[model samples]
Target: MNLRRLKYFVKVVDIGSMTQAADVLHIAQPALSQQLATLEGEVRQQLLVRTKRGVTPTEAGKVLYGHAQLILRQCDQARVDMDAAGRGLSGAVAVGLAPGTAAAGLALPLLRTVRARHPGVLLYLNETYGSTLSELVMNGRMDLAVLYGGRVAVHGLQFLPLLKEQLFVVGPASLPAPPEHVPLRLLGEMDLYLARPYNVVRKMVDEAFAGIGLAPRVVAEIESASTLTAVIADGLGATILPESMARTVVGACKAWQCRIIEPVIEAPLALCQSDHLPLTEPAQAIKEILLELVAALPGSLIAGDDTRLSVS
Candidate 1:
């Protein structure tokens, strides 16, 4: 089957109309329709059903759509890789990172190293949640990603454990000190600013609370770690975040970092990529730089086999 024809079919299904798909593809409507028909014949099934509103995918079309998306993404990656090979030290590397993971001081150093080592390479960063990042990597939208937790069991992906991060309870300096180590119960009573449910931090927090048989009362939800810290600084509410995130901007906040001891919360930091995906020169270079950055982080900040660091 022609890859171009499959692309046309996918585009038509996406737009729900051959006319619109043709316009987007800059081809005549008849040509686009003929291509779709030819693709349907090749598949030996009715891929789309025409309706008064627009075209809707048949059951077989839905399955083909999924495969088509993957094929097209791989094709795009191949083109990018070839183009990069043609230009010395030049290519594109797309990286997706969880919100606080970037703030934890990995993103900048990695980008800088890539720039210095491969001046022609284009670095693209996407700040996203763990699940979203995982999906992007699996689908070839991103060459690599830094995820907050341990190896997520996504098919065709390989995860390298980088570090284990501890969670900390942060509050305005004005808030009274609870103790050397704060109890989980204390956090339940305080107004809290939390990440949305999709975030790895939120999952960790929920698990911690579950261990203690309590649910936290969240006063606000913010997506960005920087914004969460800024809000905490303004005395909006206290929050539980990775120590890596707290330390990253500790100088700017009027916040006190305290240990949450009742149920210790820790999650692994990992570098992930599709196992079957071949890295371009630029991607490989960036990966090496990322490993270097991970190595440079303070050992005290990372989880050790024998010792678990407390948030305080």
Candidate 2:
């Protein structure tokens, strides 16, 4: 009925246990149970059913849960609206960044711009992988995220295309230059430095090799982009990475990048936000700053058209 009760209900639903919810909400288990009981009595419906595994929302509870989320979002929006009316931008914004390309090259300058333009806005950044970041945005844990294009389908989310980065063949500069742009077939025998299976880039690389009818021989599986680049620079193995990552390596190591021919894989980067939840004023301001930063980068760099370059 009230915002406080709705917030508690949401927390309980998210945590899926009265005891855990009480711990998170900083209330006694008895008090939390009593509150849910009172709420159920008022609504004249069974909201939750307990099972050995955990608590599950009843049919009626499911309906109420949906309404509860909307009400809580509206309450938060009201507060944000009032604050924005008095001050231009003075609220918190939480933004998530996926690993690989966007986090390193795209997000930092935008964060700087937001700090400069809206000093009152509190910025929170989380470094996460693509699929996880998408779910976080959908569940209202993050206001927005920079994500890889083909990996996630943001069902009820708005996506703004930021840039497109092509895949590159990376290795030590001391190695023989692969005839200008190297074809995928030429690298079939090379040992590959790859990310884990869950990584979006790793999946893309797998698909690319499959498309070319060549199976890559992965020598090492690394989670961090910098580590992969370091291994490649040491001539331990070659790698297939985004052009953004290649630029990053060229700046940090003695590495060279060759464009992948035949199936030139280009991954698009997008600014994603939930369509169901409206952005706070602070979040909107941050989004604007990010778009501006993307626009300011050179067309080739922004479009992932830069053939070879060091990270700026």
Candidate 3:
């Protein structure tokens, strides 16, 4: 079987649509279809079940898909290994980041470090919600991701705790001071603006409130950190955030008042990757750099208080 054809088939199954796969592969639909036909002919088995919405792998296709991923990853690793002989590690590595995960401080620094030290290696970064990042890492779309350790379902992924950040109740500075820390049950009295339930922080907040026999009095369900910050700073409502995120992404540290939750809710930033797929050299190098950088952050941000409980 042609490796190129196998690659194309894998892309089709990954995208779950012939048209979408053709678009991503930068080839005509007819040419892509011809390639798939040739692949099935060589294997003598139907691989995909076509449907109006998209395509799904047949039972046989499911088996091949797993092997195809390993084969493709190995082929890429082989090229990177050969290139490392003189060119320093060389290949592409994609990493996903959860939103409000300090991309401003982490992503740019990571890019600069890779460019300066490993000129031949290419780094691609994607920033999205924690749930989305989790799915990407689990599906092998991302080589690795930094996500909430508690929120992720780690069926096929390995999660390593990097740091634990305490969540704070952020509000306008003009508001009355809520002591050094506010009780979790007291959060029900505030005009809370929070992300929807799908968000990691929201899930944690819900559970924390439930544990205390109270529900947050949410006035708004906002997904954008900027909007949440703006509204909260304007005295519209209050929101919860990690210390690092409040200091970096949310900015206006002086304008907003942050009170630690009484029973601190610290979410861990975990490095997650597929358990079945080994990291390529380029990916491993990048991972090391990320770990080292995070290790240097303020004690408040890198606190490993719950590191022992974050293993997955």
- Residue-wise C-alpha lDDT for candidate 2, range 9-52, written one tens digit per residue: 87888889988999999999999889988889989999999787
- Compare candidates 1 and 3 on TM-score and give the better one: 1
User: RMSD in Å for candidate 1, one decimal?
Assistant: 4.9
TM-score for each of the candidates? 0.84, 0.79, 0.80
Query: Largest lDDT belongs to which candidate?
Result: 3
Candidate 3 residue 270 C-alpha distance from true site, Å: 1.2
Clashes of 3: 0
Which candidate gets the maximum TM-score versus the true structure? 1
lDDT of 1 by residue, 130-228 (tens): 888888887767898887755346567887777777778878887876776788878888888888876777888987898888888888888776687
lDDT (tens digit, per residue) of candidate 3 on 125-216: 89888778877777676888877664455678777777677888777776775766777777689998888997777888888888888889
lDDT (CA) per prediction: 0.77, 0.76, 0.78
The residue pairs that clash in candidate 1, if any, are none
In candidate 2, clashing pairs total 0
| Candidate number with the higher lDDT (1 or 2) | 1
- What's the TM for model 1? 0.84
